[model samples]
Target: MKLKVCGLTKMDQIQELISLNTNFLGFIFYEKSPRFVLNHLSLEGISAINHQGKVGVFVNETIEKIAEISEKSNLNFIQLHGDEDENFIKDLRKNVKKEVKLIKVFRVGETFNFQFSIFNSLVDYFLFDTDSKAFGGTGKTFDWQILNEIEIPIPYFLSGGISLENIKNLQNFVKVNMRENKTLTKLNTPFALDINSKFEIEPGSKDLEKIKTFKSLLK
Candidate 1:
């Protein structure tokens, strides 16, 4: 499983996460988020990192604005954590020339469905997170069992309430789910695990020791 550390803000915290060789690092651009990074870190500073390219996270942001931030930040990926429609993402991709990966995040709830056939063709990947009216960084876990009922054609990342204490349990959950339905293997997909608020001491401030210890388990 690939590890993605989200809600990055400080340069020191960014460096620490890079040292862990995390697969992806996310920077929140949403102004409302307590973990917002656009005001704290400059585009050049984030691009200077030698490892783990940055991902710009946005919520209900305009396409022009997203494009501007992506260029200025030199972001390698965009994670849409808002209620962006499929047409919006299609246009955003057409406007940007960079080899940008698009990650569309869906907030899971009791009625949440994984009808990938509707939007899978538009974006590169899906990120499942817990649903909250305010949007991500809620640090709450939705039922992992819900994933078993959906059909995801593209690769995805599992987010929401993930922490050091529950990661092993999550892995075990996936393994057990796989055992129950052998057809799931036919999906032939690589699911990345996204870790956010749980690894932080506070909003935008990550706990390196906690991250390192959690990563050690993967090894």
Candidate 2:
């Protein structure tokens, strides 16, 4: 299971997350989000780390702005947490040629349904998060059982309310319950465990010891 520490803001917190050797570090670009990184930080500041690719999180942002930021910041990926259509994703891929990865986040709720065909051609990966009108950083856990019913085409990251304490439980459950399921294996699917609010002292600050413990457990 790969760990992605999202909602990064401060340089110190970024350094700490990098020290954990987490696979990915996310920077929220949505102004409405509490974890939003200020524009002054620049792409250089965010990309200063020797490890972990910097991801820019956007919500309903214009393509021009996303392009400008990707160019100026040298961002490795774009995480679209908005209600973007397939056309927008197609355009983004056509415009950017850095083997740019796209992570399309889906908000899970009782009414949510699995619709992979709509996005299968557009994104490199899919991320499942708890549904909220306000977007991510909800700190709420959705029913992991819901995944059992859906058929996804691409590799995905499981998000929402993941902490050190529950990671092992979740991993065991997925392995035991999903191992024999043909639909899951048919896609050649790879899943990553995404950690967010559970390891944080606040929006951007993470507890290093907890993260270390989490990494150890995963190992």
Candidate 3:
């Protein structure tokens, strides 16, 4: 499994994660978010980071704004963590560069239908996170067992309240899920683990030692 360290606000932290070879680096664009990247780093500052996995997370933001930021920040991927439906995604897809990938987030509660054919063609990946009134960064876990019941067609990132204590459990769960998915060629398993609040010392500030330990254990 891959690791995605999210809610970054510091250049040193970003460089540290890059040195650790973290798979994805997430930057929140939503002004309401406590870890909103613009508050700490300018668009040019974000773009200056030498990494390919930089992901810009937005919440119901306008297509033009997202495209502009993505371009300015040199973001390779875009994560929509809001109520963006298929039509909106279709329009955004057309507006952005063709190489830029899209990750549509699903804020899962205790139980969800797990039937999301509407976005099958619109997005490149699906990110499952605990439902939050605050739009994620809740540091809470939804029942991941809920995913075992269905077949996901594309790769996904599992987020929400993932910490050092439960990281092993999550690894075992993914192993089992992969084994079961082998028979179905079209089925997909989690491609990455997204960590945020649990590894933070404060909003937007990450604890490097905790993240380093987690990475060692994950290996």
Candidate 4:
């Protein structure tokens, strides 16, 4: 499984995450977030970082802005974490660089309906996170059992409230899913695990040792 450490801010922490071979380093572009990348690091500064898995998180942002920021920040992926519909995704796809992968986020609440036909061709990946009014960084987990109810066509990143304490629950869930006859043979397990607030010492500031230990435990 891949590990994506999101809401990164400090350069040193970014370097530490990179050193740990973190698959994706996410930078939040949403201004409302306390861990907003722009508030801590300059676009040029982020652009200069030599990492292939740099991701920019946006919430209901304009296509123009997403395009510009993706280019300026040298983002490898654009994570759309809001109420962007099929048309919005199509438009954004046309505007951004072809090399840049798009990861459409679905905030899972009490009930979720997987209608992925419209998005199958538009995005490179799908992210399933806990639903929240704040868009993200709520650090609250949704019922993982909800995932067992659907057949996800595309490989997705499981996000929200992931930490050392609850890691075993995910492991057990995956084990059970593996044995399920209904699980699609064509669909693989979750592509990655996206973690944010739970590993942070504070908003945007990651606890290096905790993350290091989490990775070690996961392995």
Candidate 5:
């Protein structure tokens, strides 16, 4: 599986992940988040990074602001992680460059109903994260069994509480779920694993050794 390392703040660590070929590097735009990228790096600073998979994570942010940030930071992808409705997304898509990919996030809690029809046409990808009052980065995992019940059409990123302890079992989990949910054959398995807080030594500070070890195991 591809790996998306989220909540990045340090410049050196960001370069390290790029050198490691991490598929996606997430930077939080929400001012409320402890891992908010602006707290450590400026938009110009982020734009200077020579990586193509830079992702900007926003929560209930205005379309104008998202577009402005994307432009200034030169983001390759945008992740909507809040109660953004269809109209919000449609308008945002129109305002942003067509080459920039859109990822709509769905928080999975006790139960989840995957409405592929509602978002399939609107976004390039979907991200399923554990439900939390904090928007994301709760360091809690939802029931992976819930994915088997949904009708997933596009590729998705599985997030929340994914750590070294659980990384090895992820492949098995996907295989078993695929077998049990026969309809899943029509859809691809998770395109990537979105990891954040679990790999961090502190908020916004990732443990480089842990990430290296995890990547080695995946190989």
Candidate 6:
């Protein structure tokens, strides 16, 4: 599985994470977020970061702004962590560069039933996270078993309360799904893990040793 360390702020930490082989570096554009990247680094500063997995996360943001930021910062992926519908996604798709992939996040709470056809072509991936008023980074996990009831047509990133101690249990989640005959195919497991608050020394500040251990644990 791949690892996406979200809410990056420090340049040194970002470089170190790249050295540690973090698959994705998430920069939150939502101004309300405590880990908002722009608060710590300028757009030019972010643009200078030498990494292919740079992901810019947004919540109900304008398409023009997203496109502008993506171009200026050279983002490889745009993670929409809001209630953006198919029309918005289609429009955004037409506006942004073709090389930029889109990851639509579904904040799962008690239940979620998506009409997969709408998003299958609209996005490159799905990101499942805990539902909270503040938008992610809550360090609270929803029941993973909830996924067993639905059929996810696309590969997805799993977020919410993922810590070193609990990551080992993901195998069990796969096993349970397999036993239920729900998935032994592409949807068998999450393509990546989107980690945030759990490994942080403080909001926007990550603990490198913890992240390094998490990466090794994934191996």
Model 1 residue pairs with clashes: none
TM-score of 5: 0.95
Q: What overall lDDT, based on C-alpha atoms, would model 4 receive against the true structure?
A: 0.89
Q: Best candidate, TM-score-wise?
A: 3
Give the Å shift of residue 129 in candidate 5: 0.4
Among all windows of ten consecutive residues in candidate 6, which has the lowest summed lDDT?
Answer: 180-189
Clashes of each: 0, 0, 0, 0, 0, 0
162 Cα displacement, candidate 2 (Å): 0.5
Q: By the lDDT metric, which is better: model 4 or model 5?
A: 5
The C-alpha stretches of model 5 lying farther than 4 A from their native spots are 114-116, 177-185
**Model 3: per-residue Cα lDDT over 19-95, one tens digit each:** 98999999999999899999999999999889989999999999999999999999999999999999999999999
* Residue 56 lDDT (model 3): 98
- The parts of candidate 4 lying over 4 Å away from their true place are 181-188
Question: What's the residue-level lDDT of 1 in candidate 2?
Answer: 66
Candidate 1 runs further than 4 Å off: 180-190
Give lDDT tens digits, candidate 5, residues 66-123. 9999999999999999999888999999999999999999999899865656988899
Candidate 6, overall lDDT? 0.89
Model 3 pairs whose backbones collide: none
lDDT of 1 by residue, 130-165 (tens): 998897777988888777666677788889988877
Structural similarity to truth (TM-score) of each candidate: 0.92, 0.90, 0.96, 0.95, 0.95, 0.94
RMSD in angstroms, all models? 1.9, 2.2, 1.2, 1.5, 1.6, 1.8
Taken over the whole model, the C-alpha lDDT of each candidate is: 0.82, 0.77, 0.90, 0.89, 0.90, 0.89
Residue-wise C-alpha lDDT for candidate 2, range 68-137, written one tens digit per residue: 8776767777999999889998888777755778989989987567565789878988988888878876
Off by over 4 Å in 3: 184-188
